[model samples]
Target chain A: MTDAIQDEIIREFDGLEWLDKYGLLIASAKKLEPMDEDSRTDENSISGCQSKVWIQSYKRDGKLNFNLDSDAMITKGIMALLLRVVNNRYPQEIANINLYFIEEIGLKSNLSPARSNGLESIIKRIKEIAKNEALKDNV
Target chain B: MTGFAKDFPILEQKVYGKQLVYLDNAATTQKPNSVIDTISDFYRTDYSNIHRGVHYLSERSSERYEEARKKISDFIGARNPGEVTFTAGTTDSINQVARSLEPSLKGNEVLVTGVEHHSNIVPWQMAGAKPRAIEMDEDCNLLLDSIDITKKTKLIAISHVSNVLGSVNDIKKITEIAKDHDVPVLVDAAQSIQHLPLDVKDIGCDFLAASGHKMYASTGVGVLYTSDRFSDLMPAKGGGGMVDKVSLEKTTYQEPPLRYEAGTPHIAGAISMGAAIDYMQKIGLDKIEKHESDVYSYARDRLLEMDNVTVYGNTDRMCGSISFNMDQIHHYDAGLIMDKMGVAVRTGHHCAQPLMKSFAIEGTVRASFALYNTKEDVDRLIEGIEKVEMMYT
Candidate 1:
C-alpha cells in the first residue's frame, strides 16, 4: 500500500531506538486533544483493554472524523497516529485502508491477542463503522 | 548478574541494549537450566502413558510420575503422597473443590480475604455460593474478629499471600477459626508456594491449591492437597483412570488422589515440577527465603523513600510482590517505559479487581521478587523509574 502518512511514520521511526520511539509516542500523545468528561462515558469506552480508552466520532462534509483518547499516554500516542491516518476520510476509503506502519515500527506487540491493548479492537470497530456507513450511503 | 541468576539462562541475555531485570516473578518465573534439561531428558528417555501400559517404558514413566507426586507431597508436608492430586493449575484445583462440594456450597457463604486473586474468588461464585470478604483495616491486615460465620458459612477460602500486594494473610489463625466452627478451609498457595516453605499439616487446612509455572516449573501442571478426612468427597471428575470398576448400571471409584486425577495427565509437566522441587531443595528453601527477603526489603525501602511513589498494602508481613504507582504517571505508561529500559514489571490489577476496588485505584505497577532476583535488579528498576520521571519532566 502507498500511504504518505504511513510512510512518513515509518521514516520517522526508522533510525530510532526503542526508548526513543516510546519518547516520541509520549510526545504525540501529549499533543492529542483530551476527551471531555461527557464524551468519556461508559458507552464510548472500549472493553478488554488494560488502559481505559474512549472513542467518539461524527460525520462532517461526507467524511468521518474520530476523537480517541486513553488514560495511558503510550496508548493515546498510538491513537493519535491512528487518527492522523484514518480521520477526515470518506467511509469507503477508510474501509479499505491497510495499516502497515504498525509492523514496520516494531509495535506489533500491540496487535497481539495476548496483549489485548485495544489497538486491534479499535481498528476493527472503526472498520465496522466505516462499512456500515458506506452501506447506508449506497442505500 | 548474581550467582543464582546465572542458573536461569533466560536472564543472561540483553533487552534493548540492557541486561534484563525481570521483576514479574509473581506472574510467572523463569525456569532454571536444570528444569529445562530434566523435561527434555524425560521426554527422550521415557515418553509413555502412565498406569495403563504393561511395557517397560510405561512402568518407568509411571514410577517417575509417582516419584514426582511423592516429591510434591513431601514438599508441602502432605503427610502421605496419596493426599496430593495433580490438576491443570491453581484455578483448576479450586474449581475441582468447588465442583465436589457444589451441593453444600450452593447457598452457603465462603469467607474470603479482601486481597484474593480471581482464581480463589470466582470458583466459589461459579459453584453458586456467595463469597463474603473478611474485613481488614486500612493497612490491609485481616480483621479476623469481626466475621459473622453463622450456619450459612460453609467454607473459608483464603490466600496465603496476595498476588498483587505480597501481603501474607494470617491463614493459620483463620484456619483455627474455621476449626472452631467445624468449617473446612482451602488455602490458595499459588503466590506463596514458590517463595515460602509450606506445610499443609502445619497450617491445618483441609485443602490447598498451587500452580507449577509460578514456581520455576512447567505450566499445565499443579498440586491440589486434600486432607484424608475428606477423602470420600465425590471426585470432581470421573473417567477411565479414576474408577475401580465401570459398568452400565453403576461405577465404583478408586481411593483418594488417583480418584481425583481422571483421564490422561500431563506426565512430563509433573516430572518437571518434581525437578523444580529438587532444584529449589538443593539450594534449600531457607537460603532462598533469606536472599529474597533482603532483595524485597531493599526494593520496598527504596520505593518507599521516593516521595513521588505510593506503595500499596502495609501489612505486618509481606513478600514476593510490591505494588506502587508514581505521582502523575499512569501505571501502564510507567510499565511500557520500564520495559524499554529492560525492567519487566507487571502493571494492572494482577487479577485481583476486588482488591483494586478497595484501594480506590484502577491498577498498580508491581515489581515482584524470586530467588534469582538480587539487589542489583532492584537498583535497575529504580533507575528505570527515574528515567521515566526524567522523560515526563
Candidate 2:
C-alpha cells in the first residue's frame, strides 16, 4: 500500500536527530532527478513561496508522475519528500493521500510559517494536478 | 543587573526540551511581570473611558493615562507632554506623519536612509511622495556624504538605530545636515528607544517615532514626538475624542496630541508602557546600554571567529543586535534549526528588503538582544548556528 511508503519515510525521519530532518530533506532533494527546462513554465510553477519552485505532473498508463524543483535547496528537499510518497502512483490514490510525513517528521515545526505556507501550496498543487488527471481519464 | 534575565517570566521556560533563548528583540521584546501586572491592575481596578467621563473610574483612568504620557515625555526627554502623541505602535505613528505631511510635500521627495524598516519607508510612499534612499557604504553604514538634501527634499527620515544592521546612526550629525538644508528630520526610534537614552532635543530631530512592545511594554501603544515648530497638524483621523466642537457644517479639532488620537485610546496599553519605562528607568539606561553593548560585542566576536560566518554592520557603535549568515546556508533553514535548538532569531528581509538587495543577499539570521538577554543566550545562538552548518555537511 502507498501508506507503507509513508511509514518508511516517517521511520527514516524519526530515526534522525531533530536538526537532521532538514539535512535529510536536502539530501533527498539532491538525489531527485532534475526537471526539464521546458517544464519550468508558469503553469508548472508554484506560487506563494518565497523561493521560486516548479512542479510538473503527467499521466502515463493510469499512473501520475510529478517532477518538483526549487531555487532554495531546503524547499527542493521538502518537495522531494512529497514526491517520494506520491510520484508514479494512481491519480485517485495521490489525491486521496494525506501526506502525513510532513507533520510526522516535525518539518513544519522546523520551518517558518512562510515556508510551511509554501509547503502547503506545493501539496495543493500536487493534488490539483492529480485530480485533473483523474478528470481527464473520465473524459 | 547581572541576573536581570529573571525579570522576564517568559525567559525561564523551555521550548522543545531545551531552555528558551529568545534573541529576537528587534521584532518585539517579552514584557516584564511589572508591565503585565500594571495592565491587569488597570482593568481590574480603574477601567473606564478616558477624557470625558464624570465617574470616579473615568477620572482615575484619565489621570493615569495622562500621567503615563508625561512619563513617556520624560523618558524620551521631550520638552512638552503635548508634543508626544499616543499611537498604535511605530507603524501607525509614522503613517500619521506621512498622511499629515503629504499635502505639504507638493511633489518633493522624502529622503530616508536605506536601513529603515518598511514601517519607515512604505508610509511615505503611500502618502503620494517618492522615497529617495540615502545609500549605505559597502560596509553597510549609512553614507552621509551621499545624502543629497536638495531644495526638492521635503523631509529627511532616518532610524536612530537600524533594525537590520544594528548600526547606530549619527542622528545629531544628520539632523545638523537637515538643519543646513532647512529640511525637517524624522527619526524612527523603534530600535533605539529600548537600547539608548533618547533625548529628542539632543538629537535635534523634528520628529521621532517609537513602539512600546519593542521596549518591554504591551503591544498596540507607541509615541510620536513632534517638535514645537511642527507640533500641530490637521487630524489624520477624526472621531468623537479628537473633536472640540462638532456641527453638521463644520468640526473643530483639539490640540496637537489629542487631535492625532481618535476614538477610545488604548488607556491600559499606555499605562503599561509607562510601567515598562519605569522598569527600564529603575535599571537605568546607562547600565542597560553597557550590558547590551557587551552582549552585542561578545556575540559579534564569537560569530566572526567562525570562518563561514559573515557578520554585518560596524561593531564600533552598534547596539543590541548581531545579524549574519553562514556560507552556503539559507537564513530560513538556519532560523528553523535555531528554533529547534530553542534559540529564537529573526530571519528573512526583516522588512528591509531594499537594504537586503543592497547587500546582494536575500536575508540574514538576526539575533537581536534586549536587557534580559545574556552572554549565554549568544552562546546558544552560536551553538545553534554550528549545528545548522554541521547538518548541511
Candidate 3:
C-alpha cells in the first residue's frame, strides 16, 4: 500500500517540470505581497528559509487548503510545486504521503544541499500540521 | 614591487592556467620565503620542548622560544615580555580574556560595536556579560555619539578596523572615553596591526589581541598584550608551565602570561612569527601602510565610477578592504564568476553578521590587500567586478 502511494507521488511530480509547467503558481508564490494577519502567517512565524517564507492554511469543506508565500524567487517556486500535490487533501491523506519519492525522481541530485534541506524541513512541517489536524478530527 | 611579489612563492603558482591574484589576505596572508625558511631551520637544526629540559638542545630551544616572546612584545610595543601571552590566534586570545575577566566584571556591562568580527563578539557574550553595541553611521563609521561611557560599563571592546567595511576607528579616543568612566578597554587588532601603526601605550587600551597569519606570519601563533598593572587577574586555563608549584592539595600559579598559557607553546610557530615581524620591519610598515591605502583608494574610486555597483564603507577613510555589490547579482554568484577569472575575493558576511543585519544585506564580496599586492592586482579585481556587473545587470 505504501509503495503504491509512493509511486503515485513520484508520477505526479515527474509530470510537472516545476518552473516551466506551473509558471503561474511559481510567480504567485514568489511575488507574495504583504497581506492582513488573517490572510497570511506572521513573517516571524516563517521557518526553514535563508530568505522569508509565509505559509497559511485553512480547512475548507473538511479538506486542507494551503496558500504559501516566500520572499526568495526559487524557494517560492519550490513551495508552489509542493503545494500542488498536497493542498486541499484530507488531513489523513496528506499525513500518509511519502516525500522520499522525490529522491527516486532525482530531485535531490539537482538541488543544492542547503535548498534540499530547506525543502525537507518544509515538507516535515506540513506533515506535522496534517497529523495534528487528523488527531483533532478523531478526538 | 615585482621582486617583492616573487618573494612569496605561492604567487608564482598558476591557477587554472592563470597566475593567481590573491586578494583574500584578511583571511590569511601568504607566507614569504623568509618565514618559510625560519620555520624549516628551527625544525631541522634545533627541535626540543621548551622550558622543561636541562639538556643542550632543550636550553637552546628554550632561549629561542623566550626570545620570540620578547620579539612579539617589542613588535606590539608592550611594556614587558611578561605582558605578552602566546595563543593559537586572535580567537583563542579573545576567548582567554572573555573567560578570565568575566568573574571580575560582575554587575558591569561590556560595550562592543556592531562592526566587530564574530570572534570578538561571541566570546564576550558567552562569558555572561551584557553585550551592548555601539551604532554605526550610514557610511559605516562608528558613531561616537551613541556611545554612553557610564560607570556601569566595565569593559569596552572594539575592533581597530572593521574586517568587512575596512573602516579604522580612532581607538585612542575611544579608549580615552573608557578611561574617563574608569572602564578598561580591549582592542581587537587582528585587522589593524598590519596596516596601521599601533603602540599599546599610545592607545591606552588595557588589552590588545592580534593574529600572526593576518600579518605575514605563520598560522597557529598569536599574541595577547595585557597591562602589567592588571597581571593579578585570573586566567581562563592552567597547566604544565603555567604554575610555579603543583600538588594534589593545591597548585600555585605563576605570573601574568604564564598563568594564561596552559599547554606546551608552539615553538616553531613563535620562531616564524619573529621572522615574519623582521621581514615586515625591513620593508618598513609605514611604506606598506601607504601602499595598501593607495590600493584601497584607487579600487574604491574606480568601483564608484562603474554603473550598477554599490560599494559599502567610507571611501575617504579605509585600509586595504572594499565590500561591494553589483546590481541584480548574488554575492556568491559574483564570487564564482571572479574565481573563474583567477581573481580571489571573499564572498560572505566576512564574519560580521550583525553588520550585515544593519545593512539589510545577505552578504557582500570583499577584496582585501596585503604588502605583496600591486596596482595590477587591483585592476584585475576591478575588471572582474565589471565582468560580473555586465553579466548580471
Candidate 4:
C-alpha cells in the first residue's frame, strides 16, 4: 500500500470517537490467520500473557508490515491498536514511537494490573520485532 | 460483648457511619485488646535485644521471649519447645521447609493437594521440585489412593484446612501415607491452627507451619514445628544469633530452632502470640471447633436455599470459610455490593488460582467466620447475598 493509503487507514482509526468504535479494527485483526507452528518456530512468542500471542513483522519495500494474533479477545484488540500505530512504517519511524504512549490512548484503563501487564507484553513484542528488523539493517 | 468488640480498636472505626463487620477471619483474624496490649507492653516497657545479652533488660526480655516459644510448643502439643522456630508468617515457614529440604531431595517429585494455598505450592516449585497435586474426591476430600508415591517422591506438603474451600484434610492419614513411603510431610496449618486442636505427635508430620496473625496474635509472627529426628536441617537464611561461634576463620551454627531464627526476633509478636494462645486455651479449642462447625452448617444450609447460588467444598464438614458464587454477577461486583451493606467478604481466587481454574470460574466471594462472629452476622451476610442476586438477576 502507498503512503497515502496507509495515512487514510490511520486517519480512519484516529477519527473514531471511542475505543469501542474500533471493534472492526479488532475484528479484522483477529480474522487475520495466525502464523502456523512451523512459521512461529522461534522469536515470535509473547511473554507475560496467559494465552499465546504471536506477532510476525515482514519488510515490504523497506516498510514494516505486521500480522498479529492472540488467543484472548481483549488482547487481540490491544494488539490491533498497537499495529495501527507501529505497523507499515519505516524501521526508523517504528523505533522512534514510544510504546508507553498507550496509557494516553486509555485502552483498558479499568483493567487489573495483571491484565495491564499482559497488554504491555503485547506492545513489547511488537517493539522487539521492530528492533530486530532495525538491527538487521544496521539502524 | 460490646465492650469486647470495643477492645479491638479497628472495630470502633465507622465506615460511612456504620460498624465494620470483619467476616474475613480465615484470611487473617483481628487482634483483640489483650493481644494488642501484650504487644504494646513489650515495645514500651520491655524493649531490649533478646538472647546473647548480659544486660538486665536483655535478660528479662530473653526470658519472656523464650517463654513464648515454650507456650507455642505447649499450645500445638509439640514435644519440645526447641522444635518451634520463629518465622515471618505461614508463607515464610513453608518456604523455609521447602528450602531446607533441598539437600535431602534427590529427585524432583513432591506430593501436594489441589486445595493448597499458592504460598505452599510456589516455594516447592522454586526449589526445582516437581509438585504432583493429589486430586480431590466428589466430596472435596483429598483422595490418598490417587497419589502415585514413588521412590522419586521426596516430600508431601499438604494444607491442614483449605483457606478457600474450608475443607479439612485428614492430615493423620496423609502423613501416614508419606511415612509408609519414608517421605517427610509438611503441614500448612495457617487456617487450622486457629480453629482446630492440633497435636504434632498424633499427626506424626515431619513439619507443621502456622501464622500467629490467623490465630488472633500479632502480625509478622509465625511458628515452624519440626520433628526432633529432622532437627539437623539448616535454614534458608543464616545470620546473627543462629550461629554458635563466629570468627574471621569459620562459623559454627546453633541447634534446630536457634539456627532457623537468624535476626533479632519479633519480640513483641512472640510475646503477643503467647498471650493469644493462652486466650484460646482459656476458651477451649474443642468448644471453638464445635461452634465454628455449627456456624458453617447454618451458613451452608441458608446459602443452598437461594437459587443460582453454588457453595464450594464439602458441606458435611467445613470449618471457618464458605466460598460461593452468585448466578451471573462477577465476584468483584458481589464483593462491592456486600461491602455497601456493611458485610465484608473476600472476593477473587482467595490466592488459590488453580482451584478457580479447576472449576472454570474467575473467582468466588468467601465469607469466613471466627469465635467472635455470631448467627446474626451470618444472617446479615445472607441478606447481602440476596441483594447481590437481586442486582444481577
- Give lDDT: candidate 2, residue B380: 90
- The stretch of ten residues in a row with the least summed lDDT in candidate 2 chain A is A108-117
User: Model 2: residues >4 Å from true position, as ranges?
Assistant: A15-17, A34-45, A50-52, A71-73, A108-117
Indicate the worst ten consecutive residues by lDDT in candidate 2 chain B.
B313-322
Q: How close is candidate 3 to the true structure, as a TM-score?
A: 0.78
TM-scores, all models, native as reference: 0.98, 0.94, 0.78, 0.76
The TM-score between candidate 1 and the true structure equals 0.98
Across B1-393, the per-residue lDDT of candidate 1 in tens digits comes to 667998999999999898999999999999999999999999899989999899999999999999999999999999899999999999999999999999999988899989999999898999999999999998899998886788989999999999999999988988898899999999999999999999999999999999999999999999899999999999998887999999999999999789999999999989999999999999999999999899999999999999899999999889999999998898998998999899999999999999999989999999999999999899999999999898787
Candidate 3 lDDT tens digits, B123-195:
8778877778887778877778668876667799989988998888888889888887888889999998888
Tens-digit lDDT track of model 1 for A40-121: 9999998888899999888999898899999988899999999999999999999999999999999988987668467888
TM-score-better candidate, 1 vs 4: 1
lDDT of 2 by residue, B270-344 (tens): 998899999999999999999988888899889989999998877348886678988988787788778989999
TM-score of A-chain in each prediction?
0.97, 0.87, 0.66, 0.64
Q: Distance (Å) between predicted and true CA of B287, model 3? A: 1.2
Report the Cα lDDT for candidate 3. Answer: 0.79
lDDT of 3 at A69: 59
lDDT of each: 0.93, 0.86, 0.79, 0.78
DockQ of each: 0.84, 0.51, 0.07, 0.05
True contacts kept of each: 0.80, 0.35, 0.00, 0.00
Instruction: Give the winner by DockQ: 2 or 3.
Output: 2
Model 1 chain B weakest 10-residue run by lDDT = B143-152
